[model samples]
Target: MRRVLLCLALFFASPLLANSKTLFLNGVYAATYGDIAWDKGDWRGSNFSAIRLKAGIQVVRIDFVSLTLGFQKVGFYSGMHKWSGDNDIGFDYRGPVLELHLFPDAPFGFSFAGATGTGYSYLTSASQYHYSSCEGCKIDAERSALKVGEFTAYVTYKISSQLEILAGAGTRSVKGEIDYDVDRGGVHSWEKGDVDSWKESNTMVLLGLRGSTL
Candidate 1:
């Protein structure tokens, strides 16, 4: 009986024994999906898709605004498939990322935030294209230096004093490369073709459940 009373006392006193800041950490399950159009060639319009794991930190007790910094690991899959024969090609892109956050109190006392970041991506695999009447072509190259950018907006709702639920949407742009081999037909001496600085952008939707103890 004495131990139960002592525990109750500690529970009541715990609120007064705490610090000022509320440190929050959350995991976001995100997916980016969108379409990309190309203007310089006879290629089909490309569509982009990506999956990422993102994390963030938020401070508490601030009235007007709060800040957050985030990190992500993104994996990308993209390609253009030709309609003739088996001339199909694709690229797998992987990367590490960093992000900035700006959270503000909106008109209804709700939280809204924006984010942007850079990512360094590496090309993981390349597949060769083969046609029925023409010789097969292979373009294998590994590239690890690419640029990334993002913009996000979110709404956060407090479930309790120590937990919150976040739902948001954002746009992400990642760079990649596509190489086309022009030597298969033997009609042109171009040998190889390069599509440098190729960019893919997608719209992302995410949900996060966070717990805080700061």
Candidate 2:
């Protein structure tokens, strides 16, 4: 009887010690909205919303949690608004990221954390047009993909053992050809190699919540 009781105590204690490792699922919602301006002061408003999935690993979780690494993927909605000929103006985007997190505890009983990461994004657009008084002005127009690299940072809080939240901002610098196809003279082409890209490098806010079993 004594031996059985001792074995049972050790079994429960072993589980608590081994449970130091945890896996969590996280979801993030983001919005990017801004306007574009040209030399003639032509401005237009554009905005997009995206969703992301993330998985994290806690390398160290003793005393104060030390390190965490994660991967996330984001997708955006961009489609044609109007079509003049075969030409249309539309948008499509995708981004992939790698992130690292660090947490520090303060004496006043408040906890803080910072996250930094790198990501790559790709975008494609199409446009078409016809004469105001002409008919059957058929055109098929598309552009080569425009790609950019981005970096982001944020401050975070831990509301409880199972919940966490964050708020922050980031930027993206683009480098690619601004090539377009048109039907004015039967599809004219030009290699506009990096002639001041459009719609990138904007400030953003991030809000996230995470839950897990401890």
Query: Candidate 2: what lDDT?
Result: 0.35
- Model 1 lDDT per residue over 43-140, tens place: 11433333333444443324554444434434332322233332232323233333322333332223333434443333323433222233474333
Show pairs that collide, candidate 2.
87-127, 87-128, 88-126, 88-127, 88-128
Q: Per-residue lDDT for 137-197 in model 2, tens only?
A: 3334333354645466655555754344545556544443344343445645432322334
lDDT of 1: 0.38
Q: When superposed on Cα atoms, how far off is each prediction in RMSD?
A: 14.2, 15.3
Query: Least lDDT summed over 10 consecutive residues: which range in candidate 2?
Result: 33-42
Task: For residue 7, give model 2's deviation from the true position in Å.
Answer: 43
List the candidate 1 regions with Cα displacement exceeding 4 Å: 1-51, 58-61, 76-137, 140-145, 177-192
